[model samples]
Target: MSQAAYIRDMMSDPASDLATGPSEVSSFYSNLNVLLTGGNGFLGRLLIERILRSCSGVNTLFLLLRAKKGKSSEDRFEELFDDVIFDRLKREKPGFAQKVRLIEGDVGQIGLGLAPEQRELLRATNVVIHGAATVRFDETLRTATNINVRGTKEMLRLAKEMPNLKAFVHISTAYSNCVREFIDEKFYPPPIDSDKLLNLVEILDDAPLQHLTPVLLGKYPNTYAFSKAVAEDVIRRNDHRLPVCVVRPSIVIATSKEPVAGWINNVYGATGIVVGAAVGLLRTLHCDPDMIADLIPADYVINNVIVAAWDLAEARNSNINNADSSKNPEIDEPPIYNVVSSCQKPITWGKFMQQIEDFGLQIPSMLCIWYYCFKLNKYEWVHKMYAIFLHLLPALIVDSVARIVGREPMLWKAYKKIHKFSAVISYFATQQWRFNNNGVLRLSAKLSPADQNQFELNMDKFSWSEYNYHFIRGLRVYIVKDPLHTGPKAVVRYARLRLAHYTLISVLCGIIFWLLWTLVRFMGI
Candidate 1:
């Protein structure tokens, strides 16, 4: 049965037991103090917004932010609230911003760059949410290791100093163990000893390290995944015995419903492609149309994160109470939850593309360069040919015309960059992943009814059509920064571009046919 149908059946069947729900989950965070890293990031911002708006029992969120652009971390904290996300909070939950306090620090630094007083203050934190890491797939091994591997080690060290630390929720990716086809909610052995790799990365120079990268990343696809896999190992291998749980969420998109329905702030991950395609710049993608697009909403991910923190903390408390009477100590292991859509409402790439295209036509972007039409091809060579003929050829012509007319030539550069980026992401798009999210379902079932509704993470109840429509609208408004009033102009431009595309194809075919006929007559064959 489809996950959606299974969930529906579970909800309707009164005969089945739902008593595994969280008996004491609801008010676990009353007067709870939190120490959160990655305050200025995309997910960081959403998590903060959700906590302030929804997690009412929470006391304060002490964010660790690095000072940048000559601004103090405290000064830069103001910039975070200036986002449209906080706009809703500022009006509806007027004083919720008061719950947030910024501490000057960098995860990459010694002791997380925390000052003595800051460290002392953070010692009072009962819960630690480690959401900080460089998530780019193409990041260097040295860089990814420092932040993902070493940084996590530093956070665990800091967690030890926290006299009251109950739960440590580390944000990981579902693809960390992606080398395997069917991933269970368990940690695989590290590819290499993390400590050895860390030392080697520190000692090796740049050029040599670059040369050694492929050798180091053997079975792993990229440095990001390798580092994350090793980071998970770091946590699993930790001797600190601290309460820990890793939340692995897949392809996080805009909010389905939360601070605002379909609210997105950045153009990272799939957001770039969504916005790029909506603005009519992206035309072809090298991806399998049948592969499952394991997308989970940012808000849903956040909701699960919050509840997971509560549940994990409760489990640790139970362990403490049963410490003396322990039945084999229950594996001293931190539970991992795979927050993905595949185990729930699985949507194929073909369906996802159709939804995006349908909505793109309905709510056209003002900044569109062409019609919102795109092809998803499984063949890499076909995509390459399309890139050359359809993408670069037109781009070169446009850029050449601009150069001739004394305008800054840019279209060719844009296409080159676009194709390069498409190449980078195509690896994942063509591959199918079957993530086992039994852990996620078990987590949800563990939640009390009231807590379940308040912090719902179930994708079975989600409607994709409505979500896609609002998401495109949100992309237009928030990410594209385009006005709704410009829709009419965008539609006209789409029509013009479509006409130009057809005319160009016709002209090229006619020229080829004419040349062939002339050659045949000249030969007298």
Candidate 2:
């Protein structure tokens, strides 16, 4: 069959025998008590909301939270409700707050550092979704590993004790093995043994460990990726009797389609590119415009997680009677779903950039760019040279001006920090990695049409133009949370600023070039 026919068949509603009935949703829900670590975070928040909305039969959602000074878990939960992210949930389910129970806990400590009551709640839960981890690209290894690797181990330990546990879904990154050119739905052990890295961090002080991070992570681009890879390894090694699923999503960006279009709450991933471009701070980025960006929406990832949990539970239950065989399936053979876009259909980075630019122009007359240029200057060596120059020159100049003017240089510091972050991420920007998603395809093949629509990440159905509009809105409202940028006033201000800056830079470069040419002529060349 042609790939199109195959996909259509795969997406077609399953036969009644294969379909999950209402009772299944109820069973998934009543048996569906969930322990969600980092439930307040961007992806976590979306996942929680999605489950609550779509899986209304869900009995309870135990949100693991750390107790803050002078504030109770109840207070934290209340604050979360106040945010607009939960507004839709409140409207849809008036009493939905009752289903959410915040368990006082911290993931970085043993047993999730839960209290006796919280521990009891966790033990009684049927599913555990581990989504808590540091996403900062330049985070310290000590900090990243603590929450990413150690926290995962602690969660697994907790899951192992749950008598009625069905599925343990660990949220990981598609870039977990980014050092490799081709990634498949398979476990690639961490560059360093997880235990060894944990032990080394424990022995070394923060300063020493920070210095050694480069050596420790080696070819891994950043602490986030390195630590997540280790965490996945830990999960694979410690699978002991629990059905687990590893979800590796690539560069999760704004929502392509969901509860709301272009719904993005975090500024970490490709949202940074949109924000930088919209504000004109990023005039030139050293990236292969033609390469696939491999971005999946946050909601799409959450949907996959839910479906994976259901499928894993059903599959495990089916194999329960066959568990005693000498040839039991590989313990490490737990499904590793590459929740990425490269396989379904590829979207080029250049097209994405163009869409954003077009979206930016549609804001208003005041926000329109007089003229803009995107010169495709590709050089084998100059990309790195430009990266270094762009990263440092702005900060150096800004800092120098600040000192001369007797003013604090906040922009320079922000620039320096972002530059460091870009240095780590630029490697991926400059190259593309192919992920073999045969597993994702196989998983999709088994899903009912209703389930497939609910859990879809088909890039072939993605509309970049519409996505870019939401992308810009999501960046402004959700990521930046800048009221000024949401309306026309901000658009006017941005346009004036862009024109001023462009003129200044153009004049300066023109004068410098003219002076150099005159000098060459004076030298009698």
Candidate 3:
């Protein structure tokens, strides 16, 4: 039976063992002083919004943010709240903004770049959610290691120092163990020792390190996954018996349901794919159509992260009360939850693409350069042929036209960058992995019906078909900055583009046929 059906049956039966009392989750955060890194990031921002809105009794949320592009941490925090995602938060909890406090720090720096007083202040933190990391697949090995590997070690070190640390939730990617076909709720042996690899990056110069990256990465596909795998090992080695758990989410996209439906703040990972295809920029993708998409919504991930912190802390408390140190105490490793969709609610790439095309074209973007059309190739050679004809040829012609008109000739350059990016992500797209999400189910089952409703992470309950409709609409509003009010005009414009696209194709075919006929007649064979 599906997890949703099982949960529904369990809830309906009064004799069932599952708890139906007031939520322990929100109560766990009562008077809880939490320190959260990556509070300025996409998921981090959602975390802050959800915690403040859902767990009303929680004390303060200390956001660890570093100043970037000359903006002070305080300035950045103010601007962060200006996003439309926070609009509903402002209405529901008028005073939610007051709960957040910013601490200037960089995860890449020594001791988190904190002053002595700032470090002392964090000693009183009850919960720590380490969500910060560079999500870029093509990031430099040095940078990826610093932020993902070394940064994790530093966070663990800091968490250990906290006198009141109850739970430390580390946000990781489900693809961290992508080299393996089947992944369980446990740590795989990392490609290299965390400390040893850190030392290597520290000693080596950039160019040589870049050259050595492929060799160092070994079976891992990219720096992001490699560093995250190593970072998990860092936790395994240095957690120091803290209440820590890892939450690995796969291809996080827009919010399924929450403060707002289909709300997305960034165009990373799958969001980029949807947006690129919707805008008619991305024409060809090299991927297995049958491979599972493995997309978990952002709200689901946020809910799981919050629940993981509570669940881990509760487990720690229970373990303390039980106190069985004699029974292989060293075997008590941190729990890992693979927050993915495929286990409970699976959708294939072909279905994913068809749904996007069906729903997305209905509300096409005004920013679209061509009619919304894309092709997926399973074979690399076939994909290359498609790329040359469908992608590069058009791009070359457009760029040549622009150069003649003295308009900077950018289409070819843009396609080059787009192709490189597509190549980088094709690794994940072409492959499928079996992620064991039994831990996630157990965690949800442990939640009271009240908590489960408020902070829902059950993937079986999420409808990807409906979500894709809103996904495109959200892309228009948030990413494209085209609101629903303008969608009608955009739709009309799209119809014209669609007509022109087919017309051009027909004319080109006719010209080719005529040329062939003339050559045959001239040859007189």
Best by lDDT: 3
- lDDT of all predictions: 0.80, 0.73, 0.84
Sorted by TM-score (best first), the order is 3, 1, 2
Local accuracy of candidate 1 as per-residue lDDT tens digits, 1-525: 332232232221221213444324436776889888887887899888777765656788899999778988877897889987676567656888677888888887758888899888888898899999988878988889889998899999999988888889999998898888887777888888889988998899989998999998887888988999999998998779888899998888988766666678777667777777777678788989999888888888888788888887777767677756365343377888899988879898889879988887876766777766578889999988777767777787778889899999897888888877787677678888777788789888887776666667777788889788768877877778775667777788778877987887687678668989999999998
**Model 2: residue 319 alpha-carbon error in angstroms:** 0.6
lDDT of 3 by residue, 52-152 (tens): 87786788899999988999988998898997667656766799767787888989876889989998888989999999999898899999999999889
Off-target runs (Cα >4 Å) in candidate 3 are 1-21, 325-331, 510-525
- Provide the TM-score for each candidate, comma-separated: 0.91, 0.86, 0.93
Model 1 misplaced stretches (Cα beyond 4 Å): 1-26, 69-71, 323-325, 328-331, 508-525
Give the alpha carbon lDDT tens digit for every residue of 1-525 in model 2: 332232233222323323543434334655378889888788888887777766777888989887567887678777876756565566666787778887888888867788777677677888889999878877789889999999999999888879999889999999999989999999996889999988998999988988899998898888889999999999888747688989999988876655566666666756776666565444456677888888887777887788778878887776776656336563438889899988876788887778877876655323322233332224435655554444345456667889899988766677656556555556777788999877777777777665666566455676667677767655655555553223567566666766876776676577669989999999988
Worst 10 residues of 2 by lDDT: 3-12
Candidates ranked by lDDT = 3, 1, 2
| Candidate 2 backbone overlaps, count | 1
Q: C-alpha displacement of 517 in model 3, angstroms?
A: 7.6
TM-score, cand. 2 vs. native? 0.86
Please say which candidate is ahead in TM-score: 2 or 3.
Answer: 3
Name the Cα RMSD for model 1: 5.9
Worst 10 contiguous positions by lDDT, candidate 1: 8-17
